[model samples]
Each structure stands twice: as C-alpha cells, then as structure tokens.
Target chain A: MKYITHSLVILLSFLIWAGTAHAVEKTSGQSRLPVTESMVNQKFIFIGNLIKRSKTFKNIEAHGDEDVFEDIANVKALYKKAELSVQQGDYEVANNLLNEIVKLVTSITRKESKVTNDQTNSLRYYNERKATIIALMKTFDEITTNEQTANESLEPRRRMVDDFLNQAKSNITNGEVDGAIVNVDKAYDVAIRITIEVRDGITLIRELNFETAKDEYLYEIDRNDSHYFLLDITVKEKKPSAKMLLSIQKLREESDGMRADADNEAKSGNYEAATDILNKSTKNLIRAIRMGGNFIPG
Target chain B: MKSGYWLFILTICLSGSGIAASFAQEYDILHPPLGTEGIYDPENPGIEYLQQPSEALSLLPSSPTGNYVDWVKAMDDSLIEPRASIYGDQIMRAISMDVIMQQTGSMPYVRFPHYDHSLILSCTNCHTAIFLPKKDANPVNMYTILKGEFCGVCHGKVSFPLTDCFRCHSSVRDKRVLDE
Candidate 1:
C-alpha cells in the first residue's frame, strides 16, 4: 500500500508537468501549424510508450504485483498529457490518445462502426475522439468563419448564425459540446465556436460542411475568383444543408410549369413556342440531377 | 469609264446580294428553304442575308457565270483531294475555278466565312455544324481548301484571287506570299 501511494504521487506529478508545458507552448504560438512532421514523430513515441505501459501493466495484474491505484494515476496522467497537447494545437498527440481511447472503449463499441448507445468508458472515449476531431475542425472553421463580414447581402442568415453561436457559447460555458460528445467518437454538436465578421463589398454565402466527400463547397468558394464571400456556418444533422434539395425542388416545379406551358403551346399548334419551351424545360430538368444519384439516388 | 464602272459596280453588288440569297436555297444545305423568311421589321430592320448567293445570279447564261456555276456547284468527287473536305478544295472542284482567272494559289478561299476562328463565327452562331458554332454543315477543311484545290470555287475564281495567300497564312510564317 505504501509503494502504491508513492507511485501515484510520481504519476500525478508527471501528468501535471506535461500539461503545464503544453499550456505554456500554446500562448506563445510556437506549437501551431506548419507543425513539423518530426514534432509529430516525437509525440508518436510518447503515445506508443503509453500503450506499452498499459499492456505491461495488464500483464503484471496476473502476478498480483500490479497496483490499480498507481495504474489509474498513470492513465489520468496520460489524459492530462493529451488535453494539454490538444490545447496547444499538437493534434498528433491528441489523436494518438484517441487511438488508445478507442482501445479503451473497444469492448463497448466492438460491434459497430459508430456507437449510438452510450456506455461508461464509451462516454470517455467519445470525448477524447471529439477533442481530436475538434482540433481538425479548427483549421476549417477559420477558413469559413469570418467570410461573412465581406458579404453584406446575407445579413439575415449571418445574424441567425450569430444568435445560435451565442447560445452555443453558453453551452460551451456549461460544457454542452464536450458533454454530449463525451467518448463516442462522433462529430459533436458542440457550440459553433468559430466566429467571423461580415464586411462590405462581398456578396456570397458559404457554409463549411464536411459531412460527405463529394461536397466541393469549399473548393467552389476558393475557385470563385471575384465579388463573393462566404457565409457563416450552422452545422447540424437534419438541416439538409447545401440548399441542394431546395434548389432541386424549385427546379422541378419550374420545369413542370414549363412543360405545362409547352403542352398548351403544342395543343394550340404553336410549334415554335412548344419547341422553345420544351427545350428550356429539358435543360433545367437535366440540371436537377446529382452525380448519378436521382433516378439515380437521393 | 467612271460611269461605266459605277454601272458595273451596281450590277455586281446588287446581283451579288440577290444571288447570295438564291444560292443558299438552291443547294438546300442547312438554312430554311427559300422565302421562309421572318417578317422584316421596318424600323431598325436587321439585314436579311440568305446566308449564300442566290443560284439565279450565277445562272446568267454567260460563259464566266456558267463556268462559275459549274465550278462552285458541280464538283467531280474524283478530282477532290482524297477525302479532302476542305472548303476551298470543295468549292474549287465543285465550280471548276480553273476556268475563272485560272490562277490557283497555295491557299484558296472556299467559303466567305471560315469557321476556324471566333471573329468569323457568325455562320455557326445558330446553324449547327461539326465542332459546332459552325455555320456551314459541310465545312471544307481549311487546309485542303487553302491548298489551291476543292473549296476554292467562286472565291478563288471570280471573287478574291487565291494568289493573295496572306489573308489566311499571314500569321503563320515569316515569309509573306512573295508573288503578286
């Protein structure tokens, strides 16, 4: 018991030291991107060492020489290390933790690619993965966040995003994003933390949607050479974002109207009028399709 | 002489315009059949070009006109460069441009408006053709036409002399056509 207590103190001290060092590095901006691959390599070793420690510790349990109290202290230390690296923008380290975290939660989530059910450690692994993903999200957030100020046209939508973000702010204060996404490794509906100001002389709306691969929305924004800016984001599962469905629905209505007009023209024997209407309606209907999705898929 | 020149000019220009319209219909190529013109607007009425010379102009019963018709309209497929669909080659063989002035150059004008460049794209603007935005459906490939053969019909014959090769090959080579 005495040996266990001493080992716990040592483990706690090491974790506190690692976290403090990471915190100091962040405020100084020394550890942000353009982050060297070597720096990632350094942390890889640390994570590997942690995994080895866990495996060895598991083995020692067979001999009854292993101390749960000391080992738990070590795990706490590892979590603290990951938290600090994540705060300092060292995501490789944080990601390494999530890899271990998945292992920690594997027994609960073994059968599914995604876990809809919440278990005890499942909650813990979810938070860790969420942190890693949030780190990835930060770079994208910076890209689309401030695009609004340049666009004066989308003032209404921008205001809505702002209001929702504020509500999210209070949630973040109360641990809303972190609490919900705790341990399951899915994209958390965290407070929309990224913020941007909309300025004048720009007229466009851009939303950062990493929901699927084929969505070249951000690439399109980058390609648009002049006179346009991005709109703020409002991420959610059911928002039917991208306004794709809405545009297709509108196009279908217009094409149907045009077809009716064409039928009327044909019935009246206005060949020229019918031809023009049919041609235009067909072109619009073709555009309503996605990359092999409709007739095709949704 | 000046009065005579004016009379000749008047005859040629008016006849050219009329013939351009009739010829377009006679061939029955791509444009709507003859006289199917839309109502002309009196105020700011657009030019009503038939897109080609009327066949009536070239059928004047004179030797030059007759020869012009023969060369521009009646080309022997054998004489045409093997599979050479050049506008100049087609026009030249079709109308026997050899009998006109009889001077053929390396490059001959087959059709008035070449479809190769945008500045000369009025023909294909609406008329569908190969590599579209092409005006004439049967485009004489510029290379064959310019080779003093096929489409060099009326263009190289009575129209613009083919010896003036600088019109098409002007930007291509350093040496301009050294001949008059």
Candidate 2:
C-alpha cells in the first residue's frame, strides 16, 4: 500500500507540471496575437472610413470608371485575404497585404495634376483661398480700427492686397483657376504683412493706479510669474555653459526664497511688505533670465 | 511492487513525449521566429534596410540634443528644398521684420521674427487661426504658452520648442548709461 501511494504522488506531480507549462505557452501566444490583430484591424477600418468620406472617391463613382471600381474591388478582396491570414496566425502576410491596400487606395484617390482634372475640386480650392483672403482683410480692418490710427505707410501694401484679390476674382470669372490661385496667394501674402505691421505698432498699456495695496501686490505677482516664465524659456533656448547654469540656478533659488517670504507676508495682511519682497523676487528672476542669454532690463 | 514498476514506466514515456513536443515547437525557416525585422545583409541587399536617423540627417545642422537636426537651418542652407505650396506655381515671398513686445517688466522684451517664419509658411498659417492679427487681442504669457496656447501651438510642437527662450526675447531694454 505504501508503494502504490508513492507512485500515485509522483504521477500527479508530473501531470500538474506539464499542464502549467502548456498553459503558460498558450497564454504568451495569445497575448502576441491581439496586439498585431488589433493594429491591422485599425488600419483596415481607417482606410474604409477614409474611402467613404473622400470627395475624390465620390467623383470617381460619379464618372462610372470601371477600372477604378475594379481596383477598389481588389482592395476589398485582399482585405478578406488579410483577415483570413490573421485568423490562421500568419501576421507577416497579413501586414504585407494591408500595406499593399494602403498604397493602392492612395494611388487611386490622388489627383492627376496639381490643378486637379476635376472642375469641382478646382472650384472648391479657389473658393477656400478667396474666403481666407476675405477673412484676412476683415482682420486687418478690425485691427486698424481698434488702434484708431491712420496707417499711411501701409496704404500701398494694403492697395496691393486689394488689387491682387480683385485680379483673382476676375480670373475665376474667366474660368482660370490656376491663375486665380496665384493671385489669391499674392493677396494673402500682402494682407498678412499689413496685419503684422498693424499689430506690431500696438503695445499693451496697463493702468498703474491701484485701488489698494492688495491690488498692487496682485499686479506684482503677475509680473513675477511672467519673469519666471521668461527665465525658463531663456534657459531652455540658450543651452548655457555649466558655470552660467550654476549662476542662474543660484539666482532662481534666491528668487524662490524671496517669493515664499512674500507669500507669508501676504497671508499676514502686510500687502505693502509682500509687494516689496515680490518685486525683489521678480528682479532676481530677471537677472537669471539675463544670465541665460536674454538681456532683459531689470 | 508491480504497480510501482508500471508507474515508473508511464512517467518515463510521458517525459520522453514532452521532450519530443518541445523539439517539434522549435521554429524552422518556413515559420521563422519574429523579432526586430529587417536585418541588413550586404550580399542579399533586401528592400527593407534599416538606417539610423543620425545617418540620414548627418548633413544637417546639429541641435542642443545631439540626436536632433536643426531643420530650419537645413532649409535655409538650401540643403533641403521643401515645397512652399501644394500648387506648382505659388511663390513664397519671405518678409524680414521683427515685432518687439515691450510689455514685459524686468525681462528682455520678446521679439518675433517674420523672416524665418515666412520662408516656408504662408501668412494664413498663423494669422487669424492661431493668433488674432492684433496686439493685446491675444493674452500671451508664459503660463498660456506652456499650456499650448498662442505661440505654444507651434513653438513647442512642430517648430523649435519653447525651452530656447532667448530666441524670441532678443530685445534689450534701452537704458542710457550715465557718464561716471
């Protein structure tokens, strides 16, 4: 009876060991399949969605091009093959087939020429450019009006933009889309230049009058935040030497300490003292930004 | 004693079968192992030869990070000619102007350069969409920029990242030094 019991234990142990190892192998294999299968599935869905939404595809369908239709049919058939390969655990073949489908779809949808062989596509492109130019002109008008200043210097450039826009409109009326696109581009360039000029002339002016010490302190806080932000950007851009970096770090630490002190003062209702400390902190940060290679006035 | 002998025989047979099964699982050429595909062989010269970014962008100017190339410099140097427009005939007229933002206290004012931007991009790319074409209209600050607003849209994304601060804050405050 002892011998039988010992033999039974040994047999049971072997069976359990084999079962665990097989389970582990099966699990690992299953984990790998989902990742590849999902990725291929996503690509398949994306292409299908793109085809459904594409204006180019709609145009092709309207034209009743048998060759293009046949090509699309082939893509569908290949997709099925890819799906079958995935099910059969042949991921490499499936990936290759998907890549081929992407290439075919791209080729099928691509415009034959830059101007586009389709009249509707060209008209759409022209209309988009015209709308953009009109919006830009409106923006320029609004900026000049807000400034309440006559931009005598920019008058010529503004005229140039208007002239180009008019020329583009005439070209479109004459059914010359290619020429219209060029004129519209020229108009866009001038309009942008005028907008930049008008914007650059205007400066942000803040009223320094404060109703209370707390209001002054709040203003100081915003100033400190701006300097801190500038310092961070300067440090990133400059790629300062190690020695310069150390100096900047020291200044930053000093500023941070001062800022904490100011916060404490503000909590105790010493707004005047808190503002002074915050001003010192902001100056320290300015020094750090200068050291980082931006010579901002402190 | 007879039962013990039979159990020993069965265990040996099972162990032998497991070993055979593991050997059978070993991959052959037909079902080769999956890994980092596309190993380059000089003689075979397959379609998918792997090339490092460093090797590809070796001719371009280096950035602060050794791995990245300064793409703007590469474009300026005419080492790469990217199309300005999708249409074949659209001309890119680059404007050279600097807009200085002097509202910053204690920090150097921010100076925006149009020359670099206009070289490749159309004015429409930024105007009215990313930025309103008026000063003070867009409340631009460090906090807003870091959060990916205003200049944050391209500065930290497609263009050079915002970490290079002095690039924009190039203007110095005009302080007259008194004769000591």
State the weakest 10-residue window (summed lDDT) of model 1 chain B: B93-102
Cα lDDT over the full model 1: 0.38
Off by over 4 Å in 2: A1-69, A76-102, A107-160, A163-183, A189-219, A226-274, A281-298, B1-50, B65-68, B175-180
Which candidate leads in TM-score? 2
TM-score of chain A for the candidates in order shown? 0.18, 0.40
What clash pairs does model 2 have?
A233-B165, A236-B163, A237-B163, A237-B164, A296-B108
Native-referenced DockQ of model 2: 0.10
Alpha-carbon runs more than 4 Å astray in model 1: A1-152, A178-298, B1-180
Cα error of candidate 2 at position B76, Å: 3.8
How many Å off is the CA of B22 in candidate 2? Answer: 42
Give the worst 10-residue stretch by lDDT in candidate 2 chain B.
B28-37
> A127-170 in candidate 1: lDDT tens per residue?
34444334424433443454323244434443544354445445
Instruction: Give Cα distance to truth, residue A285, candidate 1, Å.
Output: 62
